[model samples]
Target: MATKTKITIQDIAEKLNITASTVSRALNNNPRISEETRKAVLKAAKQLNYQPNNIAAALRNGKSHIIGVIVPTADRTFFASVVRGIEEIANKLNYKVIICQTYDSYEKEVQTIDALLSARVDGIIASIGKNTENFSHYKKVLASGLPLVLFDRTTDQLDVSQVGINDYLASYKIVEHLIKEGCTRIAHFTSPKKISIFRERLRGYTDALQDNGIPFDENLVISSNLQLEGGRQSMEKLFEAGELPDAIFSASDYGAMGAMQVLKERGVAIPDRVALAGFSNEPFTSFTDPPLTTVDQLSLTMGNITAELFFEQFKLKDKKFVPQRTVLMPEIIIRKSSLKKG
Candidate 1:
C-alpha cells in the first residue's frame, strides 16, 4: 500500500518558488494578485490534488459556503423538484446545500433549524412545516446574521425574502373556471387554514363565489388534512349530506385524486355531475383516469429562484440586498376532468 502525501499551500508555494502569501492571495482571488498568478496557482493546486480545508477557509472568510434548506417532507414530488432546482444553482456557484426534512412536526422543525445554525451555514431557505406556529426559531436565524429565504410555505410574521406563487389568485382562477363551465355549487377541500398558503387559497375560493353571486355555505367548505385518506373521508361526508357539489376545488392534487377515485366508484360522470380541479400540477394529474385540471405552481422555478437569491447575497456582501418577495402567477391546465361534455 502506498502512503498518500498531504499537499498544502506551503507545498505549492515551495514548488512554485513563490511566497505563501502570494499563493494564498492567488487562491483567494485577491485583487492585489495578478490574474496570471491566480491561474498558475490554481493549476498547480489541481495538479498536486490539494484540498483546501473548508472549515479553515470559512473561518477566514466569515462564511461557511453552505446553505441550509428546511422543507416539510422530502418524499413529495413538488419538494423534490424544488430541491433539484436549489442543487443546480448551488453547484454552479461552488456552494453546498444541507437539506433537513421537518416531517411536518413543529418540534422537529425547531430542532432542525437549531442544528443548521450550529453547523454555521451562511444562509437558509425554508418551506416551513404544517404545525409550525412559532416564528422564534426563524427569528434566531435572522439574528445570527444569516440570510434567509422562504419558499412555498411561509409565515407573515417573518420579514424575509420569499419566492412562491400567488396561492389566493390561483385558487380564485380555478374556481372561476369551474363556475364558467357551469359549476354552481362548488365545494372546497383543504387543510386547516393555519398555514398561510391554505388560508390564502380558502380566501380565494370564498371571494370567487361571492364575486359570481354564489352564496358561501360553510357546509360546502370541507376541511381536511390535505391527504389521500382525508380527501376520501371528506368526499364521503359531503356525499352523505345529500347536497353533492356541482364541482370541487382541492388544494392538493393527491386529495383531488382521492376524491375523484371515490366519485368514479359511485358512477358519477365527471364534469357532468361534478367537475374536479386541484393545485400543484403533480405528474399524476396528467395520468389520472380523466386527466385533472390543475394550477401549475412552478415548483422547480421557485426553487431555482430561491437559490439565485442566496447567491445574489453571497456575491455582494456589502450591497444593499433588500428582502424581496416574488409571487409567480399560476397557470391553469384544462383537462378532461373539468371539461364539460357538450
Candidate 2:
C-alpha cells in the first residue's frame, strides 16, 4: 500500500490560487489577512484535510501557544470550575491548556512543574500543593524566565502574580456569623501544613474571636489535613478529651461535613447544640441534613482572573515586571447548620 501524502499550506494555497505565505497568515488568524481571504483559505484547507503543524509553528514563532495549569486535584468542584474558567479565556486567545494534578503532594507538584517546563509551555498557572513547603521548585520556574501565576494556595515567598479569594476575611466572616448566631466557644478545624491559606483562615478565626470579646482557646483549635476522615478523627478526639465546643468553624467544607456526620451519629443537634460552618462551599454542603453554612471562594472568578493574569504577563515580558496580586472577596452562605437565631 502507498503511504498517504501529507497535506500542506502550499497545497491549500495552490488550490485557492494564492501564495503559501498568505495561506499561512490566514490560518494563523493574522490581522494582516483580509477576512474574505481568510475564510476562503480556511474552507479550502478543510476541503483538503489540512493538519496544522503546531510544533513547526511554535519553533518559528518562539512560542508554544500553550499554558500549563497545576492544581491539587480536579475531582473537587472548585478546581474544576477554575480550570473551566481558564479554558474559556485561553481558547479565545488561540492558546491550549495542559492540566496537571499534584494530589496535594509536594514531590508530585515538583515533578509536574518540571514536566510542564520540559513541554515548553509559554507559561504556567498553578495552585501550590498542600505539602509544598519548599519554594525552590517554584523559584526554578522564575529562574528559567517563565511566567508563573499562583492561585488559591499561594505563598509570598515568590514574587509572582497570584489570584485568590481573601481567605482571612472569608474565615472571619463565617466565624463572626456563627458568633452572631450566639456561638461562644467555637472550635476551628485547619491543616497543620504551612499552607498560607490555612494560616490565613486560622488568623481570621482567632481575630474574630478576640474582636467579638470571646476568649480564644488553644484547645478548641484542631489541626489536621482537613479531609473528611481527618474531620471525623478530630471530632472524635475532641469529644474524647471533653473539648466540646458550642460551635465549629472548619477551614474546609469536607472537614465540617465529617464533624456533622459524627455529631448526627452521636445524637448531637446541629445549631442547637453546636453551630457548624465551613469554607469553600462544597456542593454537598447544602444536601446535608441541616444544610451547612460555608464561605463561597468565587472559584470560577478566581480561575478566569488567573488565566487573565497569565496572559497579562506576556504584556510585561519586555519591561521590568512587578508581580500583581488579585484578591477576590468571599461570600458567606448562611444555612440551617449555623443559623441558631432569627
Best by lDDT: 2
Stretches of model 2 off by over 4 angstroms after superposition: 1-53
- Candidate 1, superposed: residue stretches over 4 Å from native: 1-57, 316-320
Steric clashes per prediction: 0, 0
Give every collision pair in model 2.
Answer: none
Per-residue lDDT of candidate 1, residues 1-342 (tens digit): 987688889999998899999999999899999999999999999999999876677777888878899999988899999999999999888888888999999999999999988777888999989988888999998888788899999878998888889999999999999989998899999887499999999999999999999999999888888788888888999999997998999999988988998999999988789899988889999999889999988988999999988777666656767888889998889898897754
lDDT of each: 0.89, 0.91
Q: With candidate 2 superimposed using the best TM-score fit, by how many Å does residue 322's alpha carbon deviate from the native?
A: 1.6
Question: Model 2 over residues 1-342: C-alpha lDDT tens digits?
Answer: 996678999999889999999999999899999999999999998898899886687668879999999999999999999999999999999999999999999999999988888777888999999988898988989998889999999998999999998999999989888888888999999999998999999999999999999998899999888999989988997899885898999999999989999999999988899999988889999999899999888988998999888888876787888889999999989999998884
